[model samples]
Target: MENKKEINRRKFIKVLGAGATVSTAALYGCAPGNHSSSTDNPALGEVPIDKMTYRVNPTTGDRVSILGYGCMRWPLQAAPDGKGEVIDQDAVNELVDYAIAHGVNYFDTSPVYVQGFSERATGIALKRHPRDKFFIATKMSNFQNYTRENSIEMYRQSFKDLQVDYLDYYLLHSVGGGSGIKTFHERYIDNGVLDFLLKEREAGRIRNLGWSFHGAVDVFDYLLALDVKWDFVQIQLNYVDWKHASGNNVNADYLYGELAKRDIPAVIMEPLLGGRLSRLNDHLVGRLKQRRPENSVASWAFRFAGSYPGVLTVLSGMTYMEHLQDNIRTYSPLQPLTDEEKDFLEETAQLMLKYPTIPCNDCKYCMPCPYGLDIPAILLHYNRCVNEGNVPKSRQDENYQRARRAFLVGYDRSVPRLRQASHCTGCNQCNPHCPQGIDIPKDLHRIDQFVEQLKQDTL
Candidate 1:
């Protein structure tokens, strides 16, 4: 019988070997289900003087920068003609250039970001550089249009839009049961989507196949079991989410362990818990400051996720230069969080669960609200207002107005005016769909009333 050490050695060898012909089952180690600094991965590259740390994929021996550039929220400016259409080309190009110059190379985007323009914008910006300069990751998001034909066409269109023949990394978008995963396979896999993708892979159009998960651990495993040979999996992993009431994204410990067992790598998302961790409460901030006075609160969260062994990269949706710079500094030469610091963060995580705030991570899952509710966006604005100490009448009025405009304007433009929040009619269809269990009709009515009052005041 092979001993534990020999078994692990063999697994590591297979990990660096050519794809899929090996026993993926041998990839898991016998150590406790947690992270450990093992052998020095020779293929791993160090972040430049400008960067901090580097993470390696156990399977492919690829060294991805610890901080990945997430193009989901690119900076926007008004068009040259100032027609109110925001021009993002220059900002996107600069950000992409800065990231690459700093030795950061993993770029993640999706077809649905920025009203379906993020992919095009990212493709154009990155195309300015050599293809080998970065790994392009995007998703097949055809859930709302759930048909097999729609899914395949969307995948084909993604390649055309990104100006790349093959995706370095491709995900099945979100991994929930309802409209997310169910619709994904219905439109993709069950409809022979995997067969088509495999043919593309054989032709080298897809370098890696992966999925980003949301609800249902079983569904995540089920997707992995499908013989499709997933190269990696992305999960919403952060110190706060480990024990989040929504689901222990802390379950990520198990999820990552399982993936490692399967020789699959993990890409982490929501490291700042959709920016909440960046705007922590004063007491928690003080505690973190006392421990590491120089690091941003967001840095602690990002490090906590990167401290793990199997994570291939951490994604941050940086919307501004300062945000990008701060993240670059954090990952440039990261100091792993101490055990006491991890405990403190876990304590902070528990404290975080005390608030009445909704658990929307801005994953855009609750989007396309049938009632024209800009659900995640509105909730995020509200949460940001409250977190930033601008919730009082003296400070919150302007922010409140902005939120009102965003919701009312988005409702008018995206959702039909008649189907606006004012017309919710208390049907309760959206209540159960909300992962956060928030009373949808109740909040919509409150927002409608507030917007009406704001309009009256402006009048």
Candidate 2:
């Protein structure tokens, strides 16, 4: 009979199918469980400028930083007119300046991020630095308008918005979504967009070309099986998703294995599972704290992604000064995970799986809902209540009254009355854009119904 370690490893292999690449003893480290006990957080300290870890791009030999800056959630401020919000230029510049000063050189952005202002905000911030000092990566992001003309114009607009003559890295953003191959072909091949991009690569306008995956395993396999020489690819990776992926996502073990086998460098996204890992429950936080009290809850996830030799970079959307500082400290000479530590994280993932939480990364892809419902805020609040154990099952439970009060109070504080889940009209407009494959209208309605039940005094 096998020991617990061997048994767990075999079980993981059987479930994931391509278990050769992932291991209970090795993958990314992430805290799992509740966040209320996450108070034992590591203190921030000095980040070394010359100590940043670098990865070599085999195709172009570009030396990219192990920690890449993801420009998806830039800091925002109320617009002068107070009608809405806009990216905070000063805040962005400070973050960029500090990141570069600490040796981070790779910055990734797309046309769809930050309500279509990410490219412009990122451009404004990065323009302060010398061209040779950093690498710029952006995407076509033409999900709605995939016509050849519209796609090419979208691609060109990136150059104008970013104020760059050429892009260091370019991608067919959010591929492999929904209809899988059909959507991929219609978005790139059928519209001649891929052909145009290849020609752009030939003209030296795009230094490296790749795509991000978010759907079926067949779609990923089909893309890799193609004749095109992919420079690098981005995928959602973290401890939880390594073998036990939620929703419609494929396991990361298979995704990473295929890329490693082809020697295709991988750019990791959602390393924290949309910030799920960092904000683990109290019990889970205690487990990680017992082993390494000095490391932040978020560091485990970052080290896991950077530990893989085949990974070119790990992206983090740093919106605050402390987050940027903490991430820099984690990657400024990364300390790879040990076999024991990796096994511990695998166990954490299993325990976390037992607790059902919605897979919302707060990427804000489902923003500006036609019905005025705040999608991410609602889902994130629901997940937080789940992690904190505030969602009551029955009025007869011991703490039912307390739990109900907390949920209702927190819900109102976290989301406005008019923009709460109750406001979701089930328009289905925000469904396709979600990378996590969440059933937006369905989940929203479910949450709304739950709130209504909680309001009732009936047992």
Candidate 3:
């Protein structure tokens, strides 16, 4: 009987039409200087930066940007004092000014983001403009100290850090993970933090209240089941997660449907799946490019996130000017995917599953492995090699020699020998820290074995 890997590889080959090849240039439209198409053909370089789509919040009637700014991954710079990395306030200011001017009116931040400096830097940028011009959304991220006093101080500190009297949207950070319902209760319910925030809402200090979910479906259902009005819920949503939610266990289809049923708006996070969708395999990129010749690979994911009527805003962490510009182009006059296009995307998702690449997004949360393994780099190199068709299957295959050489050479170059997966001792120290729920030691061991097999020309 064929094993799972064999079956998946067969499916992958079937999807790609046996040994068909797609050029990187064709997948990415064309080279920068090569514009040989007809005059009537639309230029791919023309991005509508000024045209942004807005979604009105049903509860507060705020016209939030469909492309909401996620301030978690702000641009960093060497601090003037030379202590360490710090948020680049000037870059933040420029990006914020450009986004707001381009019609992005909603900004999401948290107390825990950017080493707790995100709120202050974001405040510095947004405060320069009129307070009423943009909606500021932040979170009560007191995960360690769940006591009432600590939680309250954290909440008040957000107001001070953000330079806002009232919050437009507020969240219970990372509610449905780790200890699950027990952690949720201890962090919010038992400690009276949720009740306090509820009263704050009534007092008009918090305009909207919600929670961002991570683990345990029951905890998510329980929070939603509460009779209290939830203005919105922030969720990790994207094409891949809609059906196959990766490490989250729960699919976005169910989450979004439940929220829609309750009339609760959804604020989307990870719409690009931490940049995974944007950096797809050449074949997948070719498939999308064939359908929409002008749109970006990332734009398809953003449009999919925003197509749903229940979504209030789709948050993107724009760390660079180009990312911000590209995202703005995607949302400006958002085009909802048609039924046929949706079906096509579903097909693409299935084809992607056949490739069997590790779903690591290079989040680096599982870093500094106890054994000194560069966990993210190892996984990233493996995933990249797999995506680029450099994963050798057998010595008999036509591309086996080439694939093996590329994979081995690239792996060595990408990850230092000292920090390679071969060094992992399987202590399991990094497993719990991973948001994607990857079994770190086990995966590293598998990768190391694969590397050894490739070296022996037996894979």
- lDDT tens digits, residue span 21-106, model 1: 11111121112221211210111233345545777766456678988888877766544554333436888899888889987899
What C-alpha lDDT, on a 0 to 100 scale, does residue 185 get in candidate 3? 86
Q: How close is candidate 2 to the true structure, as a TM-score?
A: 0.90
Best by TM-score: 2
Please provide, for model 3 over 1-459, each residue's C-alpha lDDT reduced to its tens digit, 9 standing for 90 to 100: 235533543443343321111111211212122222121122245457567888888988998889899997788765555544566789999999999888899999988676467899899999999999999999988755678998999999999988889999999987886778888889999989999999999999999999988776898899998888999999888888889877755799999999999999999998877666776777898898898877778888889999999999999988778778878877778989998888888888888888877777554446445455668777767766666777877777788877787777777666669878889888786776576777778888999999999877543
Give the Å error, residue 440, model 3: 2.3
Give the lowest summed-lDDT range of ten residues in model 2. Answer: 19-28
- The lDDT for every candidate, in the order shown, is 0.66, 0.82, 0.78
List TM-scores for all candidates, in order. Answer: 0.76, 0.90, 0.84
Candidate 1: give the clashing pairs: 51-332, 52-331, 52-332, 52-333, 166-205, 242-250
Clashes of 1: 6
Residue 18, model 1, lDDT: 15
Better of 1 and 2 by TM-score: 2
Candidate 3 regions exceeding 4 Å error are 1-44, 47-50, 78-84, 367-374, 412-419, 452-459
